[model samples]
Target: EEPWTLFTDGSSCVDGSGAGLILINPDGVEFTYALRLQFAASNNEAEYEALIVGLRIATQMGVKNIQANVDSKLVANQVLGTYVSKEDNMIKYVEIANGLVSGFKTFSISQVPRSKNKKADALSKIASTSFAHLSKQVLVEVLETKSITGKEVTAARKIRLKARQYEVMEGVLYKRSFLTPWLRCVGPLQAEYVMKEIHEGSCSMHAGPRSLSGRAGESQVPDRRNGLLHEMDRSKSGGNDYRRTSEEICMGQYCMPLWYSKRNNLGQRTMVKSSHGDTPFSLTYGTEAVIPAEIGMPTYRTTAVDVVNNDKELRLNLDLLEERRELAAINEARSKSKMTKYYNSRVRGVAFQPGNFVHRSNDANHAAAGGKLGPKWEGPYEVTDALGNGACKLRSMDETILSRTWNVANLKRCYL
Candidate 1:
């Protein structure tokens, strides 16, 4: 029997979370679903939710074979056993997906580009926004919670609050302190947040635990003075410090104040040398930046400018900019080629032909195989096709093709 083909997408926004599923049966029957989630969820979570629902729907219809497509690379990789689901919520979702896959005689899930899955994407967005307007043919379901068991939740809670002496009041933890009646306590999950806000921040003092505890008794004077000290210290430093201060002043003066912007930072990257041994900026602009000192006291390039010839020279430089850029590109490519050769010299390529039995790396998929004591390689899959570039398609001994290609690095020959 031909397998059912499924395309799934998910959307999560401030309004709500939703999932869309498009299932096509072997008989050419189509089933579409738009699920509006009542509970809060991330994009990846919604993706998994949609896939689980789609798989259940297929199983209910007595469909034994399935081919699934998802726009979420993480979900697709996790389902294909190429990526490990480390987060507790994600692990639960993966377990649920695995259970659903086991029920089917054959199943495969592949990652497709978002552009190709526009219909599913639209359905997800629509379900998240106006669920009431959805067609009757498009089934709408609500997932109240993720696939987490009460026992698992209880265990997680126990682990999170393990040996910590604190009392919960209105969803917040409070711990008794000698200095105060009650001190607000943070959980394991909140540690990073507290660190970011109060300690390890751009303006934070970044004090050691002992130092921070010592200063906890001080008045508000400490915080105010710390900020002053930080500012003063930054202003007083020399070398790169002066350059940073100048850049900051320029940004503020120009009203382009994005301190942590990556685009602004990329502008400061040093230019690589071209074939003529000139920096990219020098080759294009025909001159390097004139330092403040050089401007105050004239330098060779600053003093030697003739207005009559400057216009002509500027035009000539503009005309040669494309050639300079092309030369830089060629130089960069040659450097990359040399690096690739050095890397390939150390690499021992593993080659497998069609019909060859191989075992896949078990690093991520060992959870179901007794974990620590499990075999290093999980499969005795037969290579169905060589996908070139060290990738190959595989099928299980049961004649079920895998959803994605496996890299040669992750596979080894398995002699029967």
Candidate 2:
């Protein structure tokens, strides 16, 4: 039986850097290369870049079987779909790596302990040195293995189920957790299978959030789907544009408390009656009955009539004109009032096309105006394509990271 060899490493320098990649077959033949990248990148980025380099080499060489390994927990977990990319730079790296994986015919990635991956580590350190340069040749060889298959159940590529889990919502299939090259390329059914395998311990599950040691408390399932249109949540956006029309408003705050209670029907009627009575324009009993002594006649004072009539006329005239037309003049004045293109700017944005590598900020607002980022934005992510108007599909430019789609607002173009 032919033994499989693993090639893995990273490269870096003070000014700029690149990742070093090496692939070895059972016979001890070595395939090596390096990726030259700009300076000031994180060590994790180098790891993912190295993985991409190795995978690229593997695909080109037509190696159908692989078991690439990395020492970085972040790179491994991310590629395995166990971690979420929170930093802006990380998001980009994740996206790029995902893209490369899909482009291959057969591929899978795993993370291993640093102590167990000395060869890849050595190659990475070598690439970071000043003598490091990309090798233009591809190397391959066949070799023997003491035991190609061992009792390393933990290293299996299938999803590993742990104690923690997510409940499948009604009617919703367990879609793949959008976290790999091979599973992503196969489509949704593979996702379902992965879910089953994960629950059964075949693959190592990342168990996001569920594994956190917290006292049993109320957990709010936040609505993650984009609202009514694309509006942000109230806590984040301050206002909701999807407000119900007043005609659809049968009740307000006061009615809500008892709205579903046993006395709700009676309570609502009483509240509605009280509201109607409190209005300024209502029938009032005169000091003396106007009709036959006890008969009350509703009286409208001249002053009240004049005020009501005048207000009604004003509203009628206003309703006849378009609000947009009226606002147009005001908007024009404001537009001209600003001397720059970015005054009182509601948002900052740029258009990105498919296949452009960009870094997505981990900030909730997608690198919104202020705050310190770990390394600011990081990526050489390939934009798979733009999704509608506000979101973009991204694959990690590096294979060591996971691939996922994100909103355009979260991304900043990588100049490099």
Candidate 3:
């Protein structure tokens, strides 16, 4: 019978440590697996772990014959009964590997150059890197230890129990809560980004952590209709002044927004805007403006007006104006939401944290030195503090804190 082939590799990084393996049956059907080693593990241990895991998978698949390839010379020689494992842990790993290999009717393992084992290496990188988000396609498992000697898994279980919350659905992990729906779990690195977004995002108020948490959780809900209704009831701003009014007026009057040297912006002030759903003049005056055309011809509103009638009608309009303002505010918020969504689709977000090195926009120092050709950014300053609202405190190489916090918009990360 043709022998199955297995390739194994391991990777370790600041983000995480993990192993990977590739299995190809005699018929050439391939299977790839990535093992996320949650426990802190050295590269050599990871190598052995990958081989052991691959062996177990092969055994379970009922493969009678298998040939394994590994990139690590030490692991390959030790398993082959050539170079002896001097360390206690290495010796145990060798013993465990031998036990798994014995199950196959025929088996052979050899050391191959790392380049030859690229597929396994690539898969290993997936587990070694911390992801901002995981899709349902990734198959995640707890991988309870093969034996009681697996202290890492046991310790992790204890730590999870203390948190008293969490669940895995469709291979994606989420945090459980008694009063609220599950919150998707974020990696330590991604958690910092989540906090920053909640603090500086458009919908956020500079409220305390409780408010931030509540809002962040609600953002994931499937339906926003209920929230929109609540927002309409609570909103009061009334979109009294639509910012695009001047732009729209200028565009309609002239092709470009030329600084109309002679023309006053009366058109902008009187025109209706979609966001506010009313004219600026109407909002400010609390009554429909008498347009020039209407004044020329005299519409019903203008014809019917008298001094005694005008005062009573204006007062009535003023009385019902509050309700209109609330609806306008809700419309303004919805319009802003659409704009924000479009803006975000084109922009990729960047996250910065304390201790990150960044270059600040050069002000007078570089401008005066080089005039028009001056450098745009300067200084590899260290981020000493990430103040809320996209602001940060920086320090120079000497380690003294700068006098003020800088906006992140004017900074770019300085990578070595």
Candidate 4:
């Protein structure tokens, strides 16, 4: 007989609030179970409790093989050893879940997004409030069919839908952890949300009403009354934690390099030590453009440098100073790639002349204030004057503020 899948979920009001568990068996048995855990507990604790109780019921039913689907990515990942659970209450649940896994001859846990887990999610919500005890387990044969002819029947490996960002393929979870967060839709998720490649590193889904900072980039700040009015309205509506939009910025120099010149499709570049006549490898830059696939990305100077050095083996520089030098080498390779990649484009090589409008690097404050520089390359600054070399003077559009002359590598063309 093939293994059956049990989908379970839990819900609770507070740390010590009401809790319940719901499980469904694919073979047509539907079970609604509830238990109020003593003492205040977290959502994770309730989730763990639900699973334990459901597992106990399955074991009693003589089920020998099972796949457990859950909506808690953190718990799922923790069980799979991909992430560590740091909470004290969660640790206990983790240990219990592990023990149950060891005891079951065939058992696996998988993560699913909440959208794909509607039934279990609904059951959990129902369990949270109702105290009705369905004394007997409900069983209904969902499907049964066979050909009368002496024909052979085969069943393929089952693939269960886990969540919006995950799926169970042959009982293994393929978790895609990227989510597009909406600006106005801010709050803690009852269940984990998976982030995807498109959204990548950005945190906010939609533009926030408030102009959170002084940058004055693009916004309707005055009309939105900034974040202050939004916060007050949210508070009056019973939400006290509403605040500014979530921001994510990447920074670092040799410690974390940047990548550019991806606008043109030359190919990707990498910097690394080279042992002559070996498979070439490329190191990733920290500031990389999240471009669509099939676009020509630039290649690094590592391949060229390795050929020149006749170095047969690649080794990462460990000493801080040595690493800094190695990083500089990689940065140079990246810069050359970017410049060469964009040399002939309609956009042309980045050039700044006097009176050009430009936005400072996103991390201007951080880098200038020693707060950790975000994307090192900055500008759109107008060229005040051509400086003979690969440099030009710049100025802000609004303030007419003059900026120090910058190298071509430091400028990026303005884009809306």
Please give the distance, in angstroms, between residue 124's alpha carbon in candidate 3 and its true position after superposition: 0.5
Count: clashes, candidate 4: 34
Query: Worst 10-residue stretch by lDDT in candidate 4?
Result: 249-258
Off by over 4 Å in 4: 14-26, 130-416
Model 3 C-alpha lDDT per residue in residues 16-108, reported as the tens digit of each score: 788989999878899988888988888899999999999999999898999999999999999999998899999999999999988999999
Give me candidate 2's TM-score against the actual structure: 0.29
Candidate 3 ranges beyond 4 A from true positions: 136-416
Clash number for candidate 2 = 20
| TM-score of every candidate relative to the true structure | 0.33, 0.29, 0.33, 0.30
**lDDT tens digits, residue span 1-416, model 2:** 45345657665557455576668876778865555565666677788778877777777877766777777788878877899999888888888888777765556677677677776666556556643444655355777864546655554533356312222333221222212101011122432232223222222232322221011011211111211111123453324333434343221111011111112112222111221221111122111111110011111222134564776765654564354344544555665666354553856657789867788775543434555635556565777777687777777755543455678777788876
At residue 254, what lDDT does model 3 achieve? 8
Each model's Cα RMSD: 35.3, 35.2, 27.3, 32.2
Q: Residue 105 error for model 1, in Å? A: 1.0
Model 2 stretches astray by more than 4 angstroms: 1-4, 11-16, 104-106, 132-416
- Measured with C-alpha atoms, the lDDT of residue 40 in candidate 4 is 62
| Candidate 1 global TM-score | 0.33
Q: After superposition, how far is residue 251 of candidate 1 from its true place, in Å?
A: 69
lDDT of 2 at 396: 72
